[model samples]
Each structure stands twice: as structure tokens, then as C-alpha cells.
Target: MKEIVKFSFISILFILGINIVSFSQSPNESSLGIQIEKNPEFRDVELYELKITQVFKIGNQGKDSIVLKAPTTMQIQSPQLGLKIDTIIGVSRYKVAQNQLIIYFSKDKIYDFEIFYSYFGNVANLNLIGGNLGSFYYWDANEEFWYFRSTNTKINEISISYPNNFYLLESFSNSKDIISEGTNKETFISRSIQNIPLQFILLNKLKYERKRVVKSNQYLYIYLPIDSTRNLYLNKNNIVKKIESQFDKVICFFDEVTSRNIDVIQIDYNKKGRALGNQIICDSSFFYTHHLLHEFIHVYSEIRTVKNDSGYFFLEESLTEFLAICLNYNSKNRDIYFDRKIAYYSNKSHANKSIFEVDKNSNENWDLIYGKTPFIIHLLSLRLNENEIYRILKDFYIHYSKKEVTFDDFSLFLRNQSVDKEVFSEFIRLL
Candidate 1:
């Protein structure tokens, strides 16, 4: 009976806590906001350790205690900074859990204090990709960009400072006070930090030849090392034209115009080939026409506004491969494509596992996810007309483009389409 009462009391507190967070205003005000300063020191070529300093202020508005959420990655320096005012006490305790740094303290009558800490590490949010010309990093690519406070926390002001030689090339920031010094320092201040992802490019000024190719309703931005000869220069334009033609065919099939600009980075010394959705990082040796189209198909299928982790491979990988086949089916390589596709699907390693269970991180058995799953889509296309199959996919795209999607969601879409019930039944059974 005692244990039951304890559980009941805890459940009541949980319910009340949810209600309090939902309905009531927080009993704390930002007297002095957070100021974050980051300095990056190069450890090696394109690798650096960043020292981040964050100073924050909190004022207790009521006589009741309050808690604030910080990043779990935050390392608080010992001997916390604050005065021991009767009303305004320092943070008495802190706990890290659920990806949150929970700060606890006793409330004083409108008392405030400042806390500061410095941490040194490789900024996971920042990646320095080096090419023959130079290196650059994208602000949006950092998963841990907002390392100070939890989202939805009202920050009155924010200021971030970068290195001296880093040029703020492009900014999608809504923050004001955007300034750049002659020595190549950039700083921006925001009154209220918007709860949106920050995406910008910070480029170290280097000698490079950049070609901006604009074709019919599509754009390609290519960056190459300036050391290339005139013949290689012409080859660069030819590569761009070939990729543009391939993209044109995909776009024409989908009946969708290009929504985002594509960037290709060609570095002679860097041979790490990758397609980062909108950006392609490759050496000229690996930047062939087929490789370009494979990556561009990924760019075409990036309809999700927010990523849904589970079963996202269906749209990102499987659908992409299926579309690639469609793109080549009418071409001269039709027989070759089908032969390779059959061999890939017939590989017996992952025959037992369902394609719906496949993930992007499946390394050894990636052929199951990327290669075998296309057969499902192929079967659907064979059951229905090609146009009707694309219509179903496009309809799925329209519904889940701006939102996360799941395997269940895809199944429902297939069932709800204007196709034969037997066909849909067979598809679901195969899954």
C-alpha cells in the first residue's frame, strides 16, 4: 500500500509538471543573456580543436525555485560562479540526463548571477573539408550547433565570434549586427535567438577557379583547383554539362523543377567520394557521369523537411535506385541495368530480412537495402503502368515531403492508391 501511494504521488507530480510546463509562464527572466565565443586552433591539415566559452545569466523572478536546461555536452567548471544572496543563490546541483543539463537552484527575490565555462574539443558540428585549393565548413551541417541551451528556451541575446581569417561567405541567419572586419573576422548578434537551424559557409580565402553553370531551369556550382591547365578547364565545363543533362532527364521524368542549388567540389588531392544530398565532394577522377546522376537522384528525393529516422531508407536509397533504373531503362544500357539489378537482388545474404528493416548504416549487407529493395519497387511498376507507379510515389512525396515518414506511412500510401487491391496485397506481403 505504501509503494502504491508513492507511485500514485509520483504520477500526480508528473501530470502536474506537464500541465505547469504547458499552461504556466516560466518564473524566470533573462536579465543578461548568453554570450558564446569560439576560437579554433588548427591541429593538422583541415583538423582543429575549438575552444568554446559560454557565459550565461539567469534571474529568479519568484520566491520559488526554478530549473534551466543546458546541453548535455556542457562541462561546468568547478566552484560555480555566483554570489550567495539569500534570495539569489547559485546553482545548488546539476544533473545530466535525457540529453539535457538540468540546473537546480533555490529562488531568491529577483536575484541574478552569471556562470561561465570553457571547454576544448573538436567541434562535431563543424567539418573542414579540404580540397586542392583550400578548406571550408558549413554551419548547418553541425548537429551540435546549438551547444549552449536547449531549444524553446528564451534567450534574450546571442553573439558568436569566429577566427580572424575565416570569411563569412553566405548567411541564412536572421540575426542582426552582421559585421566583418578587414582582418577577416565575422560576428553576428541576435536579440532573440530564432529556433531555426543556422546554415552558412565559412571559407578561408584561397586561390580557386569557380564555375557557375546555369542550364535550362537548373544550376550547378563547381569549384576546382586553380592549378588546372586550359584543357582541364574545358574538361570541367564538359563534366558540368554532362551532369546537367543527366539531372535534366530525372527532373523531366518527375515533372519537378530544381528546388535547391547543387554544389560540386573537385579536389585533386582529396579522393573521398561522397554525396551530401545537396553537395557532392569528389576528386575529378571519381566525378563521372553515372556517379553524378546517382548523387543527383538523392538531391531530387530530399523532400523531407525534418528527417524521420526509421525506414527513411525507402525514400532516400531504395526509391533513388529505382529512379536510376527508370532513368536508364529507355537508354542503351537497359539490358545491362536489368542484368546487374537481377544479380544484386538474387544475392542470398540478406534474403531472410525484410527490406523495411534495412537502415542506412547497414554496411556489409547494404546491397539488401539499396539493391534488393528496388525489386519491390520494380514489381510494383510492373504490376501498374510506369506513369501510375510514379503518380503513387509523387503522391507520397506530396504528403510526406515537408514532414517525417515511416514504413507504416509508406504501406498506407500504397494501400490507399488507386491500384488493384490484389496488387497492393501482394506488395505488402512481400514486405
Candidate 2:
């Protein structure tokens, strides 16, 4: 009799908690107002039972889908209907009848947030995006309700009161249509870049999916269509190439491997196609190449020197921008602005600064790192001998390429080369 009573009690608590989930999804979720943040990453949302009262169609402003993010996965749900299941990175996507993901909270629970960037994929009440990951945790003891006070991602935050509601307004300039060339091989290379902000969309009518990617290599071959507006994109590509060519003489090697291995992309909505994972954005009349090669140089270089650890920001970024520029200069000799930037940081003496301090101070002088650090490499090349620096570059790539490197790991690499660490240490101090 005692065992039976205990089992019933436990079952009752589970039932009640689940009932709370359903109740929380009801219209009364927020008592003050619902404040939603527009974040693609869903990193800044604080959920505590804010229920959905209505579903507003986003119309032209929003895409026809839903977004859900978790630490290990990110999944997108099509707007076509009922609760459907999709999966990515281990997180599963589920549908909510209402356009909102309800979070229920007790009156005593603490919640706070502010507005964030609006790429939640939809603009009007027309769409919904939710998440089940990231530094996400639920605390049952706090309020006997599912409560979340934190997440892993960061963007501007938004706060909501119980009853109050705020509309999220987002705007984007008119862009071209998409041509989806679905191929996993193409996606693999695209995803490898790791810095592009891209959204993969599925077109139900045509039965296709595609994404805009970004990555930067020294050489980029862009094909433009003949339409006047399309030709504009071509012209822009030429101008961009001119700027680089004037600066560097690249030992150009053409590899059809990229386009051949990747999926076939047919032009869809926009005449100009953009690759977010790699640098390319198209407008009807023109497109721009935001090549990430220099950025990649730093990223790859950091990986070359440092194993992936906490001490990467300064050494990676600063050295990256610096070395990338050096590589650029080596390829092309033209640099007016880069020279001046290098001169500035050269005075700073590469001092020993905390990684966080450098990162935090970055908003003010980011270009300096990219420009100056590479320039330092140039100066070092002259002083240490270009052959030596080149050897370092080649060796760095050979050893650490494709593998994770650490800061201490890189420091040791330098020590082995008999490079004076203290010299560069003081160099950063000037910054």
C-alpha cells in the first residue's frame, strides 16, 4: 500500500509539470508584454513560458519557414503546416501550432533582456523560429516551471513583460532570386569556411534548396550574365579584380575542383547570386566580392600556430590581418593605406596585452590589427629575411594546416625557429 501511494505521488507530479507546459503555451503566457529578439542564432532569447496568442503572417518581409537552434544542431521548418519534424546538428525541429514558442514562468522568476539583430528569418507575425540548444538549461526548483536564464550565443537581447507585446521590425534591400544547386560536396567546402552568415531555404513549388555562402581565396572566378543589370555584376567583379591585381601578382592556378565538386547552381530569383560562406553578394545591377582570404589567412595561421584554446584572439586576428596583408603585398606590391596602418602599430612595440583586453578594445581599432599586424610581418620579413618568413609560412601551413593549433603550441613553434618572442611581445604593447 505504501509503495503504491509513493508511485502515484510521483506520477502526479510528472503529470502536473507536463500540464504546465500545455498551459504555458496558452495565450496567457506573458503577463506584462512579450518582447522577442530577432536573432538568427537564437542565442540571446530568454524563455520562461511566454505563450502564443496568435500567428501573424510575415508576408513579403519574412521568409516562409521557421528556425530552431540548439547547441549541437540548427534546423529550419517550412511554413507549409502542422507540427513537422526536421533535424540538424542533433537538434530536432518540431512545429508549434501557434507562431510562437511559449515560455511559461512563475512570478518570482527573474528575466531580463533587450532588443537584438533581426534575422530570425521572418519579419511579420507570419513566421516563427525557436530553439532547443545552446548553453540552454532548465531550472525546475526555481519556480516549478520550465525556466531558462541563459544561452550560449550572444547578440543584442530583448526583454518581455508578462502581458505587453512588441513587434519585431526588420528590413533588407531588394536582392536577387536564388538558384539552388543541391550537392553535399559543395556544401562541405562551403561549411568549411565557417564564417559566412547563410540561410538554406527550400522552395516547395520547384522542390529545391540552396544557400548563400562566403569564403575568400586570392583568386575568384565569377561568371556574369548578359542582361544589363546582370552585366553590372560582371563589371563590379572586374573592378574588384583590378584592385587586387594592381596590388599583387598572383601565381594564378585555376582549379575547376570547387565548382565541379560543389552542386550546380542555377540562377533563381536574383540575377546576381551571392555566396555568403565565400565573399559574394549580388544586387540586380551589380555584385561585390567580400573575399575572406585575409581573414582566412589569420584563422588558418592561428590554427597553424596555436591549438584552439582561449589565447587566440590577439595572436590569431592581429597576426592574421598582418600576415594576410603581407601575403597580399607579396602577391601585389601596391599598398598605401596598409603601409600607414602598419606604421602606427609598429610604434606600439607588439606589447604583452591580455587577450580579452585586445578583443574588447577591438571595436575601436579593428583595422589596425589586420593592417598593422601583417605589416609587422612585412617588417619582420625584411629584418628576419623574406626567405625565413616564407619558410615559416610554408612550414606553418604544412604542419598545422587542417588541424587545431594552440597558443602555447605556436609560441613553441616560434621558439624553435629562434625567433625572439619578446620582440613581438613589445610590438603588441604599442597597440
Candidate 3:
């Protein structure tokens, strides 16, 4: 099955080209329309490869030319063999840019175009079934949402067709937005959701498993692949206990909790750690580590800060890491972690650079964000107790939960945190 998947994917890689079918129509008033059709197919469910056929209908009803920038692939992970443009109708010309298709339409014409493309989406987490006879594949389609730019382009609808046996596990869409759900297909109509993106998860239920644990204020869902079910079952009790304990600690430190459903999906792919909203997707190996806790803290500490803001990485990533380490480890281990981080940062070229100088867009500044910023927080924790640190953080969270904040705002908040002026000034100098 795996070999078949690989062969099919490889064969599709070389089939890239535009098959243009041209037609003409009378020009009309300026307007644009969009409709998307998505078909996800799995020749063998045991393999992680999913073949997706995406058909886009773009109607340009204008007297002038227009250019549209359409994304080639929506998933964060690039397509295995790039997208193949199987068919194109009513397009003057198109060229591939970096992960985008710059399509051109001629002036004084009406074009009702259709673009059919296929790409292999390898975003699924593997679940072996019946000792490798078959497998169940699951993945979140959160990043599968389409993004295109055009003036006054109205999306008609998006239709998704999957295997009849596949299940729509979860979605962030309103139930009313789901226009139709037949045996093998689902359609979502874009009524007033022009600004919101659709998010969903799909899974094959043959060997997939999920556990839901409801606490007093929070609901947790743990999704495990079939191969890991035995180990998960054995550790289920301890897992729940530890999660609850961590939740309590976080709530206690923050003095508040957001009552929402959190999904922790154990993915098979290496280096797949991601935390968005209340969802935590990570490799199975990091499930019980502080890394997971770091992601968890992000949910509670998320602020509406822009990437251009000074110390944006410090406020988001570093502070979250500091709190996660504090909650997950004792003083001894925490000290060791901070010492290692300090050592790493000390060797970096930007060791002496202030946290305010870290650019969120530059990969080179990541060490400062992850190492020096957290160590700075650790140093502050030494001058003031952890409880005091949590109090200040709790106050900061309250002030900027859903509001935009900058490093200057945070620095000011810390300076006013009722700590000793000399100690606070010393900590401010570290940043």
C-alpha cells in the first residue's frame, strides 16, 4: 500500500502543465465570483498520502483586465511533488510564482473560467490497523482553507468530497453554515463568512480512537492513532491526572481559565509541533514533556500583538516557555534548563542584543527569543519569588487578554508591579 501511494504520488509529480480551453463572452459590469470543489481520495487508507483534486471556478465579469494571486497549496507543509494544473479554461495566461499562481485576464471580456488542479496532501497522521493490514489516517484541515486576492471577488461556496467511510471529526464552523451533508460529500456556503476561514478535522474511523475528558471548567479531547492506543490506554489514568494537575496550576497562576474545548492530537510526523487557539498538535514523543505544556500555556497567554511589535517573540514565545518550565519542573531542573539556555545564548552572536531588538521575521533571532528572553525571565524570578512573578503575569494577562500589547506596555506593567524599585530596575536592564 505504501509503495502504491509513493508510485502514484511520484507519477503525478511529472504531470504538471496547463491545459487551456479558451472561449469568449460579452463584457458585463465589473464583478467577480468564486466556487471551489475539493475531492480527497485515498486509494489505500493505510498510507498517509492523500490525493486531492481542487477545482476552482472564477468568473470575471468586467470590462477591464484583472490579475489574481491564487495560492498553489494551502497546507503549511509543501506538496510532495507540487501542484499539477490538470485543466484551465478561459484564462489568457498564468505563471507560477513562489507558492502562488499569478493569473492574467484580458481586457474588455467576460471570463467564466475553471481551473482543475491536483496535489498530493501528506498531512495525515498514520494509524496502523490490524498489524499493518490497513491503517486509519487523520488530519486537521485548518490550513486547507483557500486564500486568493481579487477586488470584489465573492465566493459562492466550497464543496468537499471524501470517502464514504471517513468522518468529520470536528469543525470550527457554525452548524448552520453547513449547507449540505450527503453520504460522501459536504458543502459549506459562504453567506457572511467573508473574513472568517473554515477549519475542520477528518478521520478514517476504522482504527482511529479518541478520548474526551471533562473537568469542572475545561473539556479536553485526546486523539490517538490506532498503533498508540494500547500505550495510551495503559497511561490513560495518569495522563488525565497530570493534565488536570497542570490545568489547575495554570488556572491558579493566572487566576482565570477559559472554558473551552482543547484537542491534543498525537501526530506521527516528526517536527510537527503546532499550537493554534485551543488545539495542540505534536509528535507523540513530546506528549508528556514540558514542550507540550509550553504549547498549552500559549492558549491562555495569547495576546493580540502584531509581529512588528517590539519584543513580540519575547512576550509570546519566551514568557510562555518560562511559565511552562516553571509549572512542569522543580527548582533544580528549572535551574538546569535555564543554565543551558543561558549557555546557548551566550555563544550566539546576538547574545548582547536586547530582547526589544529581536525581529520576529528573521530566523536568525530565534535563539534570542527562545534562549535569552526566557533566561531573562528566569533572572527576574530569582529577584522576586515565583508567586510574585505569577501575580504580575496574571495582571498582565487581565490587562491585555484580547487587546494589543507591545513590549513597552509590558515593561511598564512590570515596573508598576509593586516590586522593589532597585530589583525591578535591574530586571528591566536585562531586557
Candidate 4:
């Protein structure tokens, strides 16, 4: 009777155009019978506003009808950033959610649809930008079209049409991706990458200047605003000297040489600095050496940690900041910085929360993660000498460089290392 009931339930699900088996697979895994080809076009590109049109060709290859839930909006929130859907075509019966569109399709049927939308206000500030007039545009292709768990999606091509007066100074993209430059319009094609999102950067020839420097055999690309006063030029030289002094220290400590060229763009943004892939976006007003070194360390020791996992902030931000200060500052300055961080964390109301409980997205928990967590790492370094701690971190980086690592995986790796059991237990207890 139980087996018969289970079979009937599955039959009902199939009749309702639902695939039960696909739910168990990974979010990016191929669905049972759904395939999607996407083409996105950006036009009327300006500093603060742009229009985007995306076309999707979806096909079903199974014997049963399927319900497709396609994301129809970009997940961005800003009072100044307004997103308006201008047009939609190719589907008559569809329901719209906050950021998703749901539609029903018949078996073996192919459907082509298009969505036109407009984005306004600080659009170029999505990653980072500097100067009075925006000089660069950064786009994360994946976030625009989020993961569809029940579909095999491929980005076929992308088109960007900018103003005629602005020339394409420099463009950056993944090696597998290709950009065909044109007078006012550019075409981007992805050769083999699927599901993985690629980042693209477009620089304006008139507003930005690029400098390429080779330090210790590693290439560094510095993009700065076109300044007539030569102040930025002098600052650029100072930045190179700082990098020259810190590059060997990072390599020696990590015991790894990152072959990829690093791009540092001086930008005016709310945040002090941020590292995306191999690019460092530093705020022009607050370009301190320690802050740049922190972002630099992020590029060198980049890890593929499971997103939003427990202790994610601890591993990504806390550890990087701790290592940056260790490598950048002298003993006295390091002690002062560590003491200040300890004091700041002690005063926070959320200081009682464990590192595992801190959320990266919550602004309230920022101090706990950035302040308390680093001090905790400092404590561990004290228990086991700094050299041993660095060795463990190096091993962790080598083992999990390109793999998705979870908090438990990190904890287990640390526990398996040859450390004192009592000290390790105390450290884990503190976290």
C-alpha cells in the first residue's frame, strides 16, 4: 500500500509539470529536459544609467510539460538605482514575482522571449569607480541572470553600445571569453564556459590613463584618473614602491606565486577598498598602504569558499585583515592595531556572538567579524607560533585553492594539523 501511494504521488507531480528528481541535484546542474540560450545587450550606456535587453531561447526535450521559473530582474537595491522593465515578449501566460517570472511550457516545444529593462543612478558604481565622470563599467554576468536550478543555461553572446565620443581604452575579461572591439559597439562571446559567471571591465579612453609596471616579475596594471596636476602620477609612483616592498614578503610567507597580473584602479566609492578577482578597487581619498596591502593579500591568497557558509566572514575578511597587518606593519604598530581592534570588539553589543554566528551581510555584525574574529586568530597565532600558523594556512591554500570549502572543512583541516590538542581545543572553544 505504501509503495502504491508513493507511485501515485509521483504521478500527480508529473501531471502538474514538476520534476522531483532535479530538485536533488546542484543548482547549476542540468535539469531533466530544459535548455536555455541567453543573449544580453547593453545600450545607451552612460555613467549613471543604461538600458539592457536580454533574449532567451528555451527548449524542452522531454515527453512531459515543464514549469519554468526564470529570473526576470537584477537583484540590486539602492535609492538612486531605479530598475524598470520596459518590454516583455514571447510569453502570454506568465506570473511575475519580485525578481522572477514563472511560465508553463509544453513538452518538446521551444520558446523565445525577450525582456527590456533600464537601470539608473550609480550603475557604474556596481563594483568601483573613480573621478568626477565615471571612467569604467564593471558587470557580473551571472548576477544579472541568477542560477536556475531546473535549467541548463548558456550565455551565447553579449553586446554593448557606448557613446561615440568615448573610445574603448582597455577592456578586461576572462581568457575563455572574447571581446570584439568596434567603433561604438562591442561584441563579447563566451567560447566554452557555462554556468560560471564572468566579470568584464570597460575603460573610457578619455577619462582614464593606464600604467603597466613590472615588480619582482609580476605585472601590475594601475588605472588612475586623467589628472593634469601630476599629483596622481606622483602617487602612482609611491604605490609602485609600496608594492615592490610588499610583493616578496607576501610570496615568501604564502610560499605561492600568483601568476595573474593585478589591476589596481583608484576609485571614489563609499568603501575604503575591495578586491574582486585579481582587481583591487581603492578609494582615492583613503588609499592607505595597509588597506592596499589588505586587498593585495586577498588577491594572492584567494580561496573558493562555500558562499554564505558559517564562519565565512571569519575565513575571508578576518584572516585576510590579520595577515595584511602582520605583513604590512612593524611589531609595535601591529601591537597597537591589534589592541585597538580588541578594544573595539570588546565594546560591541554583539561581541558575545561566536565567530560561527556572524553574518557577512549584516551591518550590525561587522565589528564582530572584522574586530573580534581577527583577535581570535591572533590568539591562536600566539598559542602556536606565527610560523606554524602560517604553515597551516599555506597548506590550507594549496589543498583548497580551486575547490569549494566549508567552515567545517576548515575546522577539520586545522584539527588534523600537528598542534597541541589542549591549545587547539581551547581555540575551537573560543570560536
What is candidate 4's local distance difference test score?
A: 0.57
How far off is residue 258 in model 2, in Å? Answer: 9.2
lDDT of candidates 1 onward, in order: 0.51, 0.32, 0.57, 0.57
Q: Candidate 2's error at 132, in angstroms?
A: 36
lDDT tens digits, residue span 135-238, model 2: 11111111211211112222111112221222111111011121123321111111122221212211111211223222332333332222323454445445
Clashing pairs in 3: none
> Every model's Cα RMSD, please?
11.9, 18.8, 7.6, 12.2
Model 1 residue 132 distance off true place after TM-score fit, in angstroms: 3.9
In order of lDDT, best first, we have 3, 4, 1, 2
Candidate 4's residue-wise lDDT over 1-431, tens digit each? 00101111000000111223212322222322211111133234333233334445566646333333433443322344334444446656655444454555566667555544444443332443424534444544434433222355555555556665443322233334545566666554544233244344556557667777775556677776665235754476765566556665666666655444667776555555767666776665434556777777777774776767887877777778777777777757877888988887787778888877765546787787677777787788888876787788878878887788887888889889977888878887887
Q: Is candidate 1 or candidate 4 better by lDDT?
A: 4
As for model 2, its CA RMSD to the true structure in angstroms is 18.8
Best candidate (score: TM-score): 4
Model 1: per-residue Cα lDDT over 291-329, one tens digit each: 555666665553663245556676677777777666655
* Alpha-carbon shift of residue 338 in model 2 (angstroms): 4.4
Residue 186 CA error for candidate 4 (Å)? 5.7
| Model 4 spans > 4 angstroms off | 1-57, 63-98, 102-106, 109-135, 139-150, 159-173, 176-202, 214-219, 228-234, 244-261, 285-287, 300-302, 330-333, 343-352, 361-363
* TM-score, one value per model: 0.64, 0.40, 0.64, 0.68
Worst 10 residues of 2 by lDDT: 9-18
- TM-score-best of 2 and 3: 3
